[model samples]
Target: MLEQGRIGTRQLSILIFMMVVGDMMLIYPSVITSYAKQDAWICALVGVPLGMALMLMFLKLSSLYPEENLIQILRSILGFWPGNVVSVFYLFFFAIGASTHTREVGDFLTSQIFQYTPVRVIILMFVITIGWGLYHGLETIGRSSELLMPILIVFILVLAFCLLPQVDPSNVKPASDVGVVPILQGILISIIYPVGELIPIMMIIPYTLKQAHRTRDVLVAAGLGNLLLAILVTISLLVLGAFLTQHNIYASFVLSQKINIGGFFERIEAIMASSWLISTYVKAMVYLYAFTVGCAELFKLKQYRILILPVSLLIFGLSNLVSPNLTFIVITVVPYWIDWDTTLSIILPGLLLLVHMFKKRWKTKSSG
Candidate 1:
C-alpha cells in the first residue's frame, strides 16, 4: 500500500534534484572528462535530453497505475509470481546501490579529510545518521532536503565563482579533439550514472500530492540539476584541465582546493566536502527508504519502519564487501556500473511500458 503521507510537488522536485546531482557532482566530472576530453561539457549537455527521456519513461509507468508503487505495478502488469521474483531482484539492486553510496561516503572521508580514521567507523556513523532519517519518515526526509538543498547549491555556486579566476578558457579549447565517438561515450556515462540512476524515483512518485503534473516537475527539476552538473563539469575542465581531471580521483575536491580569494577562502575544500556529504546523505536516505518500503510492500508487512535497523545493518555489511580497496570500487564504476544501471533504469522500464501498451490495446479490441 502507498503511504498515507504526501510530499508537495515542489518538495518532490527538490528531492529529485538532490538525488540526481548529489554524489554525482563529486565523482562524475572526472569520469566524463576522461572519456570526452576537452568536450566533457558537451557530453553533459547531450545527456540532458537523454535524462529527460528516461524520466518520461518513469513518469509514464507511474501514471498508468497511479494507485500503486513500482513493486505493485510490476505485480499487476507481470503477474504475481514473476513480479515477486523481479521485485526481489529490484530490492537487491537497491540494497547494492545504497551500499555503494555508503562505501563512497566512507571512502571519501577516509581518503580526503580524515586520513587516520577507520573506514568502518565512518561507514557506521554514516549509516546510523541516514537510518535515523529513514526512521522518522519520508516527509521528514523531504522537508530536510527542501531546507538543505539551497544551502548546498549556494556553496557549490560560490566555489564555482571563486574558481573563475583560475579557469583557463584555452584548456577547454580543441573541442571534439577526440571526435564524436568518445563524446557520445561520455554522454552515455553521464546518463547512466546521474540521470539514469533516477530509476529509484519510481518509489517516490506515488507519494507526490500533485500526481497529474509530477512528470513535468520531475523533468524540469532533473533538467535544472543536469544543467548545474554540466556547468560544474565545465568549471572542472577549465580550472583543472582535462588531463589532470582525468587522472585525479577526487577532481572536484582538488578543484575546491584551487579557490583562493585574497588568501581568505583558501583550502575551502572542506566546504565542498561538506556539501557532498550532505547530498550523499540524502541520496543514501532515498535508496534505503525505497528498499525498506519496497520490502515491506513485498512481504505484506504493516510498517516499513520496523525493517529499518535490519536493513541498515545489512547495508553496512554489504558496503564493506563492495570493495577491499578504493581501486576496486573505481574499476567497477568506470566500466561495469553503467551496464547494471542501464538494465534497471532503461531496459526494464521500457519493456514494462511496452507490455502495458499491448495489454491496453488488447482490452480495446476485445471491447470492440
Candidate 2:
C-alpha cells in the first residue's frame, strides 16, 4: 500500500535519527537539567545502553520478517484479526505522536517567538507541510533530511562553540548531587522519550531497499544519534549550569542566548530555533509518512493522499485537546509518553518476536 515506494534501511535510519533528535532538541535538555542538575549528561549516558537493547530487539524482529512491514509481520505471526488489532494500536500511537508533535511546535512558537500567534496557525503550517511530504512518500522525506541534517547540525555545533567560553567546569561539579535515583529516573524517561518512540521504524523497515544490511544501519545510526543527543545535553548543563537551565522552559534556547561572541554575535536563540525547526520538520514528515502508510494499509487504499488532509485535520484538533498550557503538556508528556511508547513500541514488538520464535521451535521439534 501507499504506492509501494522503495527506500533503503539507511534512509529509514536517518529518518529515525532525525525524529529522535528533532523534537527532543527543544525539551530534553530542560527536562534533564531539572532532575539530574549538572549530572543531566549522566542520564544520556545511562540511557544509551538501554536504548540500544530496544533497538536490537527491533532489528531482530525486522530481520525475522524481512519483506513485511510491522502490520504484515504481525498478521503472519499472530493471525489476521489479532494483527489488525495490533495495527489499530500502532495507528493510535502514531496519531497521538503527531498530535504531541503539533503541541510541541505550537508551544514553542506561542511561548517564545510569537506570543500573539494562534496555535492553530502554527499547527496548520506544519500539518500542511507534513501532508505534502507524505504525499511525496518516504524517499522524499529521506532526501529532505539528508539535505537539512547538516545545516541543522552546524547551527547547533556553532552554538556549542560560542558557549564554550562561558562553560564553567565547576558547573558540572558535585556530580551526584542527589545520588542515583534521579539519574535513573531521568534515564528511564530518556528511553521512553527517544528510544521507545523509535518503534515506528518497524513500519518502514520492510520498505528498506538494503534489507540485508538493515540490522547494521539501524544500530549504527541509532547509536550515533544517541551519542550526539547525550553530548548536546552535556553541553547544555556545562554552559548554563543546573540552576539557571533547569527552570528555563527552553534550556537549549536559553543556552544559545548566552552565546555572546564579542557581544556582536548574540541573541542566537532564533538561530537555534531555526535549527530545531528543521529537525522538527523531518520528524513530522516521518510521522505523516507512517500515518499515510497505516491508513492505506487499513483501508486497502492504493495511495494515502486522499486521507492526508483528514488526518492532519484530526491532529490539529488533538493538539488543542491535549493541553491549555505548556506546563501541563510538559508535565504530562513524561510519564504518559514513557508508558505508551514503551508498551506499544517495545513490549508489543518483543511479544511478536517471541511468538514467532516459539512457533519456529515448535515446527522444528515436530519435524524432528
Candidate 3:
C-alpha cells in the first residue's frame, strides 16, 4: 500500500482551495482579460462548471480504487510496461508543472519585489523551502495548509476590500461585447489552468481520513475556489479595465498597489506579494510532493524522501531552462499547455475508466 499519511477532510479541502487559486491569482487575470475583455468575469464564472466536471472525473477515478494513487491505479489496470510508460509521462508532467511554478515565483519576486535579486537565487530559495516541507511528508503539509490557508484567505479579502473603493464599475461595462467565441475561448483557457491543475490531487486523495465523502469535499472545495477566482477576475477588470489588465503582466499586483487608506495605509502590494508567494508555495509543494511520491512508487522504493533532492535539482535546472524569460514562458504555455494537461488529467484516466467499466460488465455477463 502507499505510505500511510492521512489528512482530515477540512485539511484536504483547504489544500485544494490553495492549489486552485494560488498561481491563478497572479497569472490568470491578464490572460483571461486579453481574450474575454469586459466579459472576463463571465468567462471565469462559466469555467466553474468545467472545473467541477474535471474534479468529478478525478473523484470518479479515485473512488474506483479508493486506496491507490494514480500511478498504482495505472499499474493495476494497464499492467507493468504500459503503466510504467504512462507513469513516466505523469512524472514529466508534474516536473514541468513544478518547474513552471518555480519560475513563476522567481519571476514575480525578481520583477515585482526584489529587482536586484538573481532569478536563480529566488528559485533556489523557494525549492529548498518547499523541499524541506516535502521531506516532512504530506501530513505536515496538510497541517501547514490548515494553519496558513485562513491567513491567506483573510489577506485576500482585505486586499479585495481595500481595492473596492477604487473600482470603477464602468470598466466592466459592455459585457460580452466580444461575442461568445472569445468568451468560450477564455473559458477553455481557464479550465486548463487552475481547474485542470487539480489533477495532482489524485495522488493525495487516497490518503484522506474519510473516504465516503471525499468526492463531495472535492466538489465543494472546487466550487468555492472557482468562486474566489471569478471574484478576483471581476475585481481585476473593475480596477484595471481591459486594456491595462491585459497588458499588465501582474495585473492583480497592480490592483493591490491601488490600495490606500488615508495615506496611512499604502504600498500594500506586499500583501499581494505575500499572498501569491504563500499560495503558490503551497501549490509547488503539492506538485513536488506528488512527483516525489509517484517516483517512489515507480521505482518501488520504500522511501520517497531519498529522491526529493535529486528531483528538486532537476526541477530547479528545468525552471531556469524552461524558457529564455517569463515573457516567452507565458507566451508558450498559455496556448499549448491545455493539450498536454487535458490528455493526462482527463483523456487517459477517462479512457482507463471506460475500460474498467467494460471489463467489469463483460465479466458479469460471462459469469451469468
Best by lDDT: 1
> Candidate 3 regions off by >4 Å?
none
lDDT-best of 1 and 2: 1
Model 2 per-residue lDDT tens digits across residues 68-170: 7777787899998988888898888888887888788888988899999988899888888888888787778778888888887788779778777777788
Once model 3 is optimally superposed onto the true structure by TM-score, how far is the C-alpha of residue 153 displaced, in angstroms? 0.8
Residues 1-368 of candidate 3: C-alpha lDDT, one tens digit per residue: 54567888888888999999988887788988888998988989988888888888888888888888989988877888998999999989999899999999998899888999999999999999999999888899999988888878887788789888888999998876898899888898667777788888889988888646766887888878887888888899998898998988788898888888999898988888888888899999999999999999998998788898898898899999986688896788766887897798778978989988997899899999
Candidate 3: worst 10 consecutive residues by lDDT?
209-218
Which ten contiguous residues of candidate 2 have the minimum total lDDT? 1-10
Residue 139, model 1: Cα distance from true site in angstroms: 0.5
Measured over all alpha carbons after superposition, the RMSD of each candidate to the real structure, in angstroms, is 1.3, 1.8, 1.4
Per-residue CA lDDT of candidate 1, range 1-368, in tens?
Answer: 53767888888889889998878888888888878988999898889888888888888899899878889999999999999998998889899889999999999999988999999999999999999999888889999999999888998899889988997899988877898799889999878788787777789888878656767887999988888888889999998888998888788889988888997869888988999998888988999999999999999998898899999999999999988868887776557888888888889989999988999999999999
Clashing pairs in 3: none
Tell me the TM-score of each prediction against the true structure. 0.97, 0.94, 0.96
The Cα error of candidate 2 at residue 152, in Å, is: 1.4
